[model samples]
Target: MTFDVKKEEKQFYSAKGPELIKIPSMDFMAIRGTGNPNDEGGAYQRAVQTLYAVAYTIRMSEKAGISLPGYEPYVVSPLEGLWWQDGYAGVDLNKKSDFQWWSMIRLPRFASHEILDWAKNTAAEKKKIDTSDIQWFTYDEGLVVQAMHHGPYATEPETVSEMNDFVSDHELKEDFSTRYHHEVYLSDPRKIAPEKMKTILRHPVKK
Candidate 1:
């Protein structure tokens, strides 16, 4: 059976409305960059491309006779990102040029630094793109308020406002001291209609 995070971890990935939850530490293949994500062929787009390259390489390692202990067939996790801006409190969609982001994909438990190194080398050779900036690390998001956002990315502020209201109603404050504004892309923009897109928006919060 292929393990799917969306199905196995529904609470984390499928929130329909603003709600509070705790996120545990998890491993990821990440690449950091700055600038507008909407820019064609930009740093953010390249970062995403590099992330998937290495992620798929590790996922298919067994077929290449590379096996790791406790490895199992699993679905590649959705694309997730951590976003922030310098000297800004919360994300400002209008100021995309000032955005700093960590585009990443969750890795399975069996993934290790050795496997990641191998994957990066293989992907770099096969794709003919630099993968030197990729990183493997664990992140603990802790307490957060998250909701499933509908519609296009430009309309995210509407959902964000609702989440902020929920946080205040619950006496929790948005905290970006350690964590970041997180997003989980559940629907591929290419296949899904913009008005029907689904994105999990998460904000770190503290009581």
Candidate 2:
């Protein structure tokens, strides 16, 4: 069976409402960019394409026999982002222009730093795009509260408000120093209706 992380890991998806989960360590191939994600011709859009290009190159590495140890066929994980800004208490949906995002793809456990380097070079050569900016990141978000947000991106505030209320009721404090507003995109907006799009929004917290 092909290893599908989304199907195998329950926490990789979302719940109907707010739920707290202890996240484990995970590696990623990350790229940083600043600009509005909605800009059709912006850095954010280009960065996302670059991420996927590299991810797919790495995923298909086995065919080249230039692969990582313990490599197995697995579905590519969803796109995830760490959203924040210079001095914002939280991500301001209204201010996409100033958004500082760490856009990333969760790497399989078998993928290592060297494997990623090879993938970056391979993708750059094949795709004829700059891949020098892509970096390796290992993150463990620890404890966080997450929920499914089903709506257009602009309507995320409503879901965020609910997440905040749930956090307060559970007596948890935001840990901005260690964590930031994070999101896992489960729906492709271009293919899904605005009201039906799904995003798993999560925030790290401390007791």
Listing every candidate in turn, what is its Cα RMSD in Å to the true structure after a full C-alpha superposition?
A: 1.0, 1.3
Best candidate, TM-score:
1
lDDT (Cα, tens digit) per residue for candidate 2, span 1-207: 678888889666767798888888888999988888999878888888999999999788878776578889989999999989888877787898889988999987678888888889989999999988899987888998888999899999999889899999999987778677999999988899999999999988889
Q: What ranges in model 1 sit over 4 Å off?
A: none
lDDT tens digits, residues 144-184, model 1? Answer: 99999999999999999999999989999999988899999
Candidate 1 CA-lDDT value: 0.91
The numbered model that scores best in lDDT is 1
- Cα lDDT over the full model 2: 0.87
lDDT of 1 at 15: 87
C-alpha TM-scores of all predictions: 0.97, 0.95
Candidate 2 displacement at residue 117 in angstroms: 0.8
Instruction: Rate residue 2 of model 1 by lDDT.
Output: 87
